[model samples]
Target: MSIIIRKSLLELIFSGAFMKRWNDKLRPMELVEVDKQAHKMIVAWLLFLLNSRDLDVVRKRALGESLIEGGLFDYLYRLVITDIKPPVFYKIKENPDDYSTLTNWVIKQLRPRIMPLGDDFMNRMTAYLMQPEDKGLARRILHAAHLYASYSEFKLLKSINRMDHELIEIEESFIERLNSMRDLVGVSELLDEDSNVLGGFARMCGRLRFQKRWSQTPRVPETSVLGHMFIVATYSWFFSMEVGACRARCQNNFFSGLFHDLPELLTRDIISPVKGSSQEIGELIHEYEIRELNRVVLAPLKEGGYEDIAKRLEYLLGLEVGSEFKASVNMDGTIVEATEEQMAGEYNIDTIDPKDGPLLKVSDSLAAYIEAHTALKNGISSGQLHHALYRISNRYNETPVIAGVQVSALLADFD
Candidate 1:
């Protein structure tokens, strides 16, 4: 993709949405006060990590049967009751047997623009929702995510005014749960090494809530950097599915979208316009970002035997890796296979036939368009946003297809 496209993508991710939550009037909650997309993304990432555990094959097989029988959908049904008095909350509470209905409702709310995996996702979600034994890792992780979301929401509330007693109580309760369950998910190991790693990471991510987008424009609710990453990752996951991305490719695109701007955690969100001021300046910023990432993030992970995670982050952020290639193991499991020159030229990436790189680019553009459209609908006036909507519309119109997916038709849904 060209530099201009890249810049526009970043700008869109940074733009915030202006919708209100159903339960905003009930309490001093930050759900509708902060970036909704970012919170959803955080929840999704937590879900991803929870699902990636390497369970023993024998145990997994044994638990798999039990999971299917034990109402896995019911577990997910309860996890989404973040509000205490919402009608949905009472509806589920009143009718305990509405698991399938509630599960489908949640899925509809959470479903992306395009579901590449389709119905298979519910089965996969069943596996992720399984809790084999007492210290069920999946259940614990969901609880942890719930607590973290509450903690982060309360923190956002603190920024606008004095923290409410109810919010403080909620935050403290989450902390207590986190403290109790820290040992369940290898957070204990991280805590022993760096006593505050978990909390620090959560706090850092929450800081993105305050980092507003379109600083010069009038936005009803500004999008944060963290929220933008979540939206991009969500979009990428759907797009990846639409293009028939392999398992590995789907995971990569989802995670890459999740942490694409992680360097911003340390460097702050360097706006796209500044980054694209000139090629030389952009290169300089990239160098500085890498240097700081190594010093602040990667170096510690390496010292703590988290090299695998560090490398994954590097690949996702395109730190040391170039964007023009994708590599995968062949079915034979010995030699690697790569797309030839003509295929690579046609698809924009040399390694993966599905071309996740360009696929993510399209998702990024779509996310930007959504951000602009949402803001405009909410009465945020900005010449830049208007121009962006027009530019992206024209750009995607001229380029109708990407990685075997009909880009124009996919985007037409937004109209």
Candidate 2:
């Protein structure tokens, strides 16, 4: 396929000097197309031409042919017109085996007339945009890009400002939504666990504290599925680290914490009232949860050869009651995997680091308590904070776990 752009616009796009000099002299010229494919590719090419001055001519030509050959002109056109630039070069270069000479040739030929934004920048943009459309970040980026691409720089700047304002608003909303979920998920022992997909779990948990609810559920807190996973994972890391567990164990704890409630995503956080109706009914629900978990999170990951991740989580969770994991497990560890009643059973398992569960639980409780206390400071004062703390303290017989650790008493250091 062949398409042509006026040499002047090509220079305008490629040579900033020419663009500046001929800014007034230049007039729009129709792009000549040799075929339907050529026409589509030219639209794609011109869209990019608007931003690229450093792309070599050879590369531009190659890009044109590649766009045509790969049936990517439409995608590229949408991207370019929307202020999103596709990675026409790097995606091809990164895996030459997938995109060999023909692809490379097209990219090289079309290179000169386009912008030379680095591949990393393009890839990050792609990743950001390609996320699920419902993602707040993606929506913000799309809105910003739409305004920027269609308007002059002056308008674009304002559009950017508005977009930022919207983002801040959304962030606040997200936080309000995630607060309850954050508490429920309860960042436990594995926040810093090491799994390829779960490595950022801690940050994710922290961010959940800020998620906003989109739905109205009086009993259920407004939180995102991702937010819950993040907090639980973080708690897992804290637990493991405080317990002085091995590095591998620490990572496993993190992964386990992240996925412990994954079944909830599939099962929809069944309330205890319904779940505890009868032994058979409860068992049936549990069975369904396990099956759905295996079918969704576990199966997909294993099919993708990510069973290692699942195993890591399960190991950290100590889901499989074995001789070895018993001594090392904490109260939260058992609670995550056990039936509510089973959790209350007189199971005497000595804590490993002695300070592990106490530190983690205190940290978790204190975080929520502080948040509630802050609300009191904001003129929403109720006896709720004090009463809640009293009830919680009374549960442990008022003998808190951090009694002996001076460092642990300094909860002010936590952010």
Candidate 3:
């Protein structure tokens, strides 16, 4: 909870892990060309948005019949699909029985992870998607966008050696289909002229695939900034659940974790050691990141009438908190009410409160530890990674709890 620990958590989140997808093995791509964890998170977020749309219609139609809700189906679907070994996926694609087996395998793997809801939701999802009916306008549109994003990522990786023309055509076709369905889905009513915002955001998220992590480490798989964001977000979500976070707090933490490093998209991944070299240097870097973020990211969104979204991002990224370092969200997702003296004296000192920033910091460290452990497991050797693992482990060893969650137990799961 000290400033040093807080800064270290931020550093680790920005530090990329080398994660290799099965597909990368077939191509000339490096062993770790993609951030597997991050990609899954992005897919999850997309699905969350899709499922979040049209709650009113879904509630009315429920009419007492139970229906799966809250984007869980979409999230689970992407999580399983992304983790599928490439060769297995290819085999499934080639045979009907294999695909069926794959689906069952996915259900089995996910069943234990998702408790309480159990197989009922998973079974419903399998049955629903197998032969989906017209669920609603929003559901359909979001579903198309999810498919488009997933396919786009898969096709691009698959066609690394192929000509761009085919890829371009495929993308164009997908976009055309999405645009055609826009009016039918009443997107204008939902978002007005800002209907294109989601698409634009998707494109930006895609850029993370190109921004490689750990530029200095050789012979290791590279993680993208975007992917790191996803991992942090996912970790934060699960950690929030462990702490019994309210719905609004969980959502805020997830999103905050998702965009924690959005500034890196503009400034690139500045390693933590460099930022921590000196207090003055770190302050200067922070200043520059905020300026560029406002000019390049937030200002434009505001100009485009996405003020609400821009404000949310600002809060998530701690832009609004400034130097006070207070909690970002309350139990209801509203900004935590704290005077400057109260924030500095109590909140800053007791950094383990069940607020957004501290919880996110803990999740960030957990993610960093996982990334380092994963890379080490994959036979990559780096002193920096080893040091990171040691440092994180040692730091958390003395601290066993955060916001009522057993932090040590959560980290132990990685071991």
Candidate 4:
């Protein structure tokens, strides 16, 4: 059954961009929920990589799906209850009966926007929210990633928060919770200031918040590459579900969307125009990205006994089939391109380890369209931004229905 990718849901997810973090505290930069959610998922990826090293493919896929689902659940719930402070929210969460009531209310409020995702998502969301604390690996990873991402922001505000009496308890609580997770594979490195591989990787992901999207253009909320990746990731998951993608395939799409722009971290955010200026220039940039990615990202990871992570990253980055935007799947150990029909039919099974690259492309372009549309709506018009909106709109106008999604209609809804 092809599901409707509703306009309200897209706006609801993108709405996180406007939701502020550490709102009451003095901050150097505008810390938004979207970017923090992105960072948390990135941290969760490393944790997933570390902990799944010994698990089978089935177990690995289950854990990956749980992490993605849990993150989305938490994000959606927070979107509805925007005014509650972190301390107050946590206190409420501590009381199971009270939190259960609050969760039910949040579900009621969000159902209208999220109903397009269908019943499975709704049921899963409720179960995850109501699940006992620390009952699963996904929950533990969630706890660690939240603290790591929050602490990254808190460190920046330390100059202002140090003397604030209210934050003293919060500071100690963060450390103590993190201390309990030291046994988790990447948790120690995450907490360590000087640890090499994992520490460097986490820092690089966090630094993406400083790398603004559409750098040449002025916008209401200048989004970061990290935040944009999350948007695409979220869209891919929704599209995947709509297309009835199998468990592994859906998870693959989500993570592929999440890390799609990682090469940008090493090469910086090279705008699409610069890359497409000429065939030679595009090829040269691609060549450089591959060389640098191997050296700076993959090589170090493999050397640190993370060959599996490196290999999967290579696949998700589309190193084998040319571009991550192209649909492909792993058959046994070989990577092969698959058609949209095959993705919907034969290749849909989890054993194929399919990644719906075409679905991801739609998600990627839709995200770009929304970003452009949102900026223009906010009265931050520019020739470049307008061209972006036009190009993306026209690009999908011809065949709006891609990978079972009404792409053209969804784009039109933005207007």
How many backbone clashes does every candidate have? Answer: 2, 53, 1, 0
Q: Which stretches of candidate 2 lie over 4 Å from their true place?
A: 1-225, 270-285, 322-391, 402-415
Give per-residue CA lDDT, model 1, range 1-415, as digits (tens).
Answer: 1111222232322332433443442435334422544543444343334344576534533332233222223323333443444345546545645745655666664344113345565566644433223355444554455555555555555555444445555556656766886655544432242354433454556566566556677665566776666667656655555555544555566667667777787777776678878999988888888888888777766665556556656666655444322432223323233343322344333133132556667776776677777788778888888887887888878988765546676556556
Better model by TM-score: candidate 1 vs candidate 3: 1
Q: Output the number of the TM-score-best candidate.
A: 4
Per-candidate TM equals: 0.70, 0.34, 0.69, 0.95
**Which has the higher TM-score value, candidate number 1 or candidate number 2?**
1
Q: lDDT-based ranking, best first?
A: 4, 3, 1, 2
- lDDT string for model 2 (182-210, tens) is 22111111122244223133222222222
Q: How well does candidate 4 score on lDDT at residue 153? A: 83
| Model 4 pairs whose backbones collide | none
Q: In terms of TM-score, how similar is model 3 to the real structure?
A: 0.69
Deviation in Å, model 2, residue 214 alpha carbon: 13
Candidate order (TM-score): 4, 1, 3, 2
Q: What is candidate 3's local distance difference test score?
A: 0.55
- Per-model root-mean-square deviation over C-alphas: 7.5, 23.0, 7.9, 1.7
Consecutive 10-residue window with the lowest summed lDDT within model 1: 1-10
In model 3, the clashing pairs are 32-221
The candidate, 1 or 2, that scores higher on lDDT is 1
